[model samples]
Target chain A: MQINSSMKKSFLFKSLVDYLYILNVGGFLLLLTTISFGFVEINVIKGGDEHWSLLAISISCISVLTCIVFLRGVYYLRKMARHLLTHKYFSKQIIKCLKISGTHFLLAGVMFVVIMILGWIGKLREGLFEFVYDINLMVPLFLMIIGLFFMIQSEALLVAKNFKEENELTV
Target chain B: MPIIINLDVMLAKRKIRSKELSERIGITTSNLSILKSGKAKAIRFSTLEAICKALECQPKDILEYRDS
Candidate 1:
């Protein structure tokens, strides 16, 4: 069959999703390899104090969990993109994927906040108050907002699906 | 739903097949089936008028309301 304009657009969007998936996986692998090879040192506290070491380990664990959550979210997003590519716009799979991905992002955001708080407390104990001025803290805030946006988008899509069903069923 | 479609009964009473009625009313058989099976959320006035004309019956003949 001949392709239409909408199909072309969907194909373009699918390609974009493919790029995002590749970039996410590649960046994650690169980060892991760099960290494991001692190329990028993640030293949170110097002198190796017991309490600071515990805080560092906890922060590292939370960061890894956040990364895993982000990866899972991207996986579900890939699934949703595949469904859209096949023109299954209102499929239940899309809604389910959206919900799963949204939850993952929200969880990642919460984990990030926990990591920041732990790091903040650690720094306060070390008498370093300059950590609060770090501009990198906006990342978790943006993640939370994006997560809520995805959740709301899924709800809006659900409403649109209901309307489509009602229109189709009307005889 | 409390509002039920009785298109099947009307079709049977008129001795018309679902396919024939759908063709006559310019609608698909699946849509006609939805109406017959009471799965339709709502019916348009134009479609109801077309169905009424095709079956030669009043609107009440094909639609009935009942308390849940």
Candidate 2:
């Protein structure tokens, strides 16, 4: 069967979605690796054993949660895009993915404040290790909080609008 | 299977070029092609009206029903 131009445009959009998901996957992997590195280094710190354990535990938790979100998010997006190509252009699965990813962003925001307080304490003390979270972390955390909310609201709006209701006639 | 666009017949009778019709109708030639090929699922009333007005024709002049 011959394909139409509109189908071609739709495929292009799917490819874009695939590329974005690949980026998300790569970012998640990078985060995991970075956190593991920190975890290992923290375990090796002298006179900061307890603090290191706490930081390691928190970073590991964040990494695990982020990976779960990233994997599920990409899975849903890929499936949703394939379904859209065969049929129409909307998905509840995609909306769910957005919700999970948005929550991940919110966690990242909170992680920032925790790191900030620890970094300030480290700075005021002498002979502390070079593993302190920077005070400037709060600004970026605030930004991440804003970003997280944006994601949450945008997805919520899309799900609420439910373009399928507006576009496709019921069978 | 139900739509048969008579765009060619209307255009020929009116001596209008596809490019000119598209410009007047504010649609791309590619979209006009879709209409002409009867591949479009639907056309907006505004766009149908534009085509009729530009070609000095009626909706019946541009659209037909073909039993599948």
Please name the candidate that would achieve the greatest TM-score relative to the true structure: 1
Cα deviation at A109, candidate 2, in Å, is 3.5
Model 2 segments more than 4 A misplaced = A1-87, A122-171, B1-68
Candidate 1 TM-score to native: 0.84
Candidate with best DockQ: 1
Error of 2 at B56 (Å): 37
**Cα-based lDDT at residue A127, candidate 1:** 84
DockQ, per model, reads 0.86, 0.03
Supply candidate 1's per-residue lDDT for A72: 89
Residue A90, candidate 1: alpha-carbon lDDT = 85
User: Which lDDT tens digits does candidate 2 get at residues A20-59?
Assistant: 7888788777866886688534342233555555545555
State fnat for each of the candidate structures.
Answer: 1.00, 0.00
The DockQ score of candidate 2 comes to 0.03
